[model samples]
Target: MKRSSPAQISPDFRRTRVVDQTGIEERAARFTKRSIKQSSKLQALYQVLNMIDLTTLEGKDTDQKVRQLCYKARHPHDELSGIPTVAAICVYPNFVRVAKKSLEGSGIKVASVATAFPSGQSTRAIKLADTRLAVSEGADEVDMVISRGKFHAGEYAFVFDEIAAIKEACGKARLKVILETGELGSFDKVRRASDIAMHAGADFIKTSTGKIQPAATMPVTLVMLEAIRDFYYQTGKQVGMKPAGGISKSKLALHYLVMLRETLGQDWMSNEWFRFGASSLANDVLMQIRKEKTGQYQSAAYFSVD
Candidate 1:
C-alpha cells in the first residue's frame, strides 16, 4: 500500500482539543465506581487476559526468557481449561525473531519495540532503520516512542513527519506510536500527540514504554481515548489504544474496559483494537480467573513471574 505524505495526511496539530483537566479526572474517577456483577466480572477477567501483550523488555533478557514468555502467552494457565492466549508477545527488536519462531502458528502476534524505544532521541535515519530491522525480523507490530523533546519544543511537524517516516518503514507491520504520556506532562499534550499519531498513520497509539515513572494513568488514558474517538468521527478511521505500565490489578483493568466502552463504544472492546501493555497483569488476571472458578484465591506463587 502506498503511504500518504505527512503534509497530506496529518491534521493541524494546533487545532487539537484542549483537554479539560478537572472534567477528565472526575470522569475517569467515575469509571472506578462502576459496580460489576459476578458473571460480568468473570467475563471481564477473561477478556483482560486475552487483551494483554505479555512483555519482556529488560536489558538482561535472553533467548530463554523470550521463549518462556512465548510459552506463557500460549498457555497462560494450564490449570484453567479454556484460558485464552494473550494478544501478543512484546520484546526488544533483538528478540523479535526469537519470539516469532517460538510462537509460530499460535495466532499470537510478536510485537517489537523500535525507533529507539522509551526514548526517541536518535536521528531519523537511525529510527527508520530500527523500525525496518524489527519488520524484517518478522515483527507483526512495532511500538515506537515519539520525539518528546521536539514535541515539547513545539516541533509538532517534526514529530508528525518522524512518525510518518517510521510508519512507511514498518511496511506490512502495524505501527504503534508510544507517546509516553507520563513524559508528555499534561493532558493537552497527550491529546495533541494522539492526533498527530493517528493522522500520521499509526495503527495504534500507546501510553508508555514501562520505563518511565507515572506511566499510563487513568486520566491520561481517558484523554487519549477521547482523542481516538474524535479522530474516528472526523476521518472515519479506527485506531487502537494500548495503556502500558503501572496497571497491574484486575479491577483497574476492568475499570479501563469500562472507560473504553463508555468512551469509544463496543467497536474498540476486542483485543484487536485495545491492549494492555503489561507483564504482571496477566498473572493477576489468571489468579482472578482461578478464584472465580474455585471460590478461593490461589497464591501468586502458582503463576510464573515473567
Candidate 2:
C-alpha cells in the first residue's frame, strides 16, 4: 500500500493547512469530559494493555532486561487468568534477536527502534543498514526516527526520501515513523511531518520517541490524528497511530482511546490501528484491571516491569 514514490507526495503535503493550535487544544481538552463507568472502564483498561507497545529503550538496558520485557509481554499479570498480552515489545535494534527468541510463537511482536533512534543524525546508508539489521534479526515492526534537523530546515524532499528508503529496508516488518513532535516546535509542522511520513509509506505515524522531555502531549497527538484522518480520507489507506511517552495512568490511556474513537471512529479502535508506546503504563493498567475485578488496588510488585 506504499505510494509509488516521494514525487507523488509533494503535491498533497504542500497543500496541508497550518493547524490552529488553540482549536486543536480546545477540542482535545473536551475529549476528556466523556463519562466512562464501571463495566466499560474495566474493558477499556484491558484494551489499554493490549494496545501497549511495551517499550524499554534505555542506554542502560541489557540482554536480561529485553528478555524480561518480552516475558512480560507474553504473561502480563498471569495471576489475572484471562488478561491479554500487550501488542508488542519495543527495544533497541540490538535486542531484536534477544526479544525475537524470547517472544517466539507467543504472538507478541518484537519492535526495534532504528534510524539512529531519538536522534536521526546519520547518513542514509547507515540508517537503512540499521533497519535491515533489525528486520533480519526478526523484528515484526520497526520504529524509526525522522531527520528532524532536515525537516526543520525545510528539506521536505530529503525527509520524505529517507522514510521511503527506510520503509524499503524494513521488508516484511511494519514501519512506524516517529515524528518526535516535541522537537518540531509547532502543531502545523507536526501535521506536515505526519503527512510526509504517511505518504512516504509509514504504516504508522507515531508522535514521539519517548526520549525527549515534551513527548506526546494531547494537543500534539490530536494534530497527528487529524493528519491521519485526512490522509485516510484521501488515500483509502488505513494507517495506524501510537502516542508514546508520559502516558502512565489508565485514565489517561482511556481518554486517548476516547479521543481516537471520536476522531477516527470505532474502526480504528483495535490494536491493528492504535497503540501506546510506554514502559510503566502496563503496571498502572494492571492495577486498575485488578481493582475492577477484585475491588482491591494491587501493588506494583504484582505486575512485571518492562
Candidate 3:
C-alpha cells in the first residue's frame, strides 16, 4: 500500500509550470564518446562486465539460439571456458514459460516485458492485468514501460500511480520501470522519471526500450545512476539500474560497468543491481571472453545472437 507523496506528483496543477532542462544538452555532449580504449589486453576486464538479458529475440529459431548460448555460457569448456553466464533470459509474456522451461535448473532468471511494452498506450486496467499475467506465467522479473505521454504532459502523478499499481500487481517478482529516457525531453525529466519510478516502488529503474533513438546514452545513464544513489542515501533502499539499447559492443558494456563502479562503487556492479538489456550485446561480451581465452577470433555462428 506504499505510494509516492503528493509533492512528488506533477506540476502544481492549474498553473503547472513547464520544466525546462537545457543543461542536459551540455552534459550529454561531454559524455557522447563513451567507448573505452581497446587494447590487446582488454580481455582482462571482460570477467566483470554485465552479461545481458536479451529481449529482442523470438520464434523457434530464437529459442534454439538462446538455448545454445545458455549451454555455452553455463558449460564452457576449452575455448569457451571461464566466461560468466548472462544474468537472465528476457522475452515477451508468452515466451516467459518457454524461457522458464529452457532455463530450469540453470539458475538463469526469466524476465518478461509487460505493461504494453514499447507503446505503453493502453488502459490502466489492461496494463495491470498484463503485469499479473506475466508474473503468473512465472517471470522472475517484469520490465514495464512508463506512459511517456503522461510523463511528457507533466502528469507525474499519473506515471507514479501507474508504477505503484504495477508494483502491487508484481507481488514478489521484481519490477523494472523503463523510462525510455530518450523520449523524456530533458535531463531533469530523466532524473525526475528515475525518482518517480524509485519512489513509486520500482525495484529497478531502466533507461530505454531500444525502440527509440538516443537510447541509453552515457550521460543520461550517469544521471539515472546518480538519482538511484541519491534515493538510496535518503531512503536506505537500494534501487537497481539498467541501461538498455544502443549498448551492443563489449567496449560499450565495459564503459557502463566502469561508470557504475565509479558512480555507485563496487556494491552495485553485481547482477542484482546492474543489467544490460540487449540482444546483440551478449555475443559481443562472449566474443571478448572467447578471444581472451583462446587468443583468436571466433566465428559469428560459433555463438548465438538471438
Candidate 4:
C-alpha cells in the first residue's frame, strides 16, 4: 500500500489515457439490456443494499441528523429479516465523531468528506487539517475532492501531490478521491483524473460530490471502471469505485453492478471494492426487496426521510 509521490507519477497527465466516447456510450448502453431472472434480481437488490454508503452532507446538518443516518445505516429495515446493513455512513468532518459513536459495534463505517468538500477551493494546509480532524474524530474513511481548478490548469503534479499528502494525513483511514466528473467536461479528462488518483494513492475513485448536475452517468462510470481495470492489469493493484449522485433506482443500480461484474469480475463485487454514494438509493432498494418478498410495493412514506 505504498503511495507514489508526485515525482514518481508520470508527468504527461494531459494524455494519460484517451477515451472513445462512442464506444463507451454504446458499451454502457448494452449493459442495461442484459436480462435478469426474478431470483437474480432479488439477489442483486440485496447486494445493492449492502453496497450503499448512506450519506448526508448539507449546510443545515445537525448532530441529530447524523445520528439518525447512523441508525438507518445500522438498521436499514428491521422487518426485512436477514437483510444486510449499509456499508458506511458518510457525513461532514464535524459530524464524524457523532456518527462514529452512533454506529459503534454495528460494523458500519463513518466516512467524512474533506478537502473543502464540494468546492475544493482552499489552501492545502487547510485541507490537511480538515482530513486530520476527521481521522482524529474516528472516521474510518475520508472522501476528498481533487482540486478541479488545478487539474484543469494542467497542474497535474500539484493535484497528485495534494492527494498523496492527504493520503498520508489519513493515517490508517481509507481515502476516497472524488474526481467530480460532472465538471471534468469530457470522458478523456475523467480517465486522466482516475489514473492520477489511483497512482497517487486513492483507495477509491469517486464520480461526484453529489452537488453537481449530471453526476455519475453510466458512460462516465464506465470510463472510470475501464481505467481501474487497465490500471489493475498494469500494476496488479485493486482500487474501488463509487458512482455517487443521481442513481436512486434499483434497476439502475443493477445495471451498474452488471457493468462492474463484466468489467472487473468477482474480485471487485463486494462493498470493499464497490459502493453507491447515494442515501436515497437505500429506500428504493428496500422497497424493491419488500416488493419481492410480499408481491407489492410499499409507499415511500414508510421509510424515514433523513
Tens digits of per-residue lDDT, candidate 1, 152-230, equal 9999999989999999999999999999988988899999999999998999999999999989999999999998887
TM-score for each predicted model, relative to the true structure: 0.96, 0.96, 0.83, 0.96
Clashing pairs in 1: none
Q: How many residue pairs clash in each candidate?
A: 0, 0, 0, 0
Candidate 2: residue 66 Cα off by (Å):
0.8
Q: Where in model 1 is the C-alpha error above 4 Å?
A: 1-9
Candidate 4 residue 280 C-alpha distance from true site, Å: 0.7
Ranking by lDDT: 4, 1, 2, 3
Tens-digit lDDT track for model 3 on 210-284? 889988987888888888877776667788998998888877677677678777887886889888888777677
Give one digit per residue, the lDDT tens place, for model 4 in 41-156: 99999899999999999899999988988888988899879999999989999999898899999999989999999999999999999999999999999999999999999999
Q: Where in model 2 is the C-alpha error above 4 Å?
A: 1-9, 12-14
Q: What is the Å distance of residue 38 in model 2 from its true position?
A: 1.2
Preferred candidate (TM-score higher): 2 or 3? 2
**In model 2, what lDDT does residue 104 have?**
86
| Candidate 4 lDDT score at position 216 | 94
Q: Which residue pairs in candidate 2 collide?
A: none
- Model 3: C-alpha RMSD to truth? 4.6
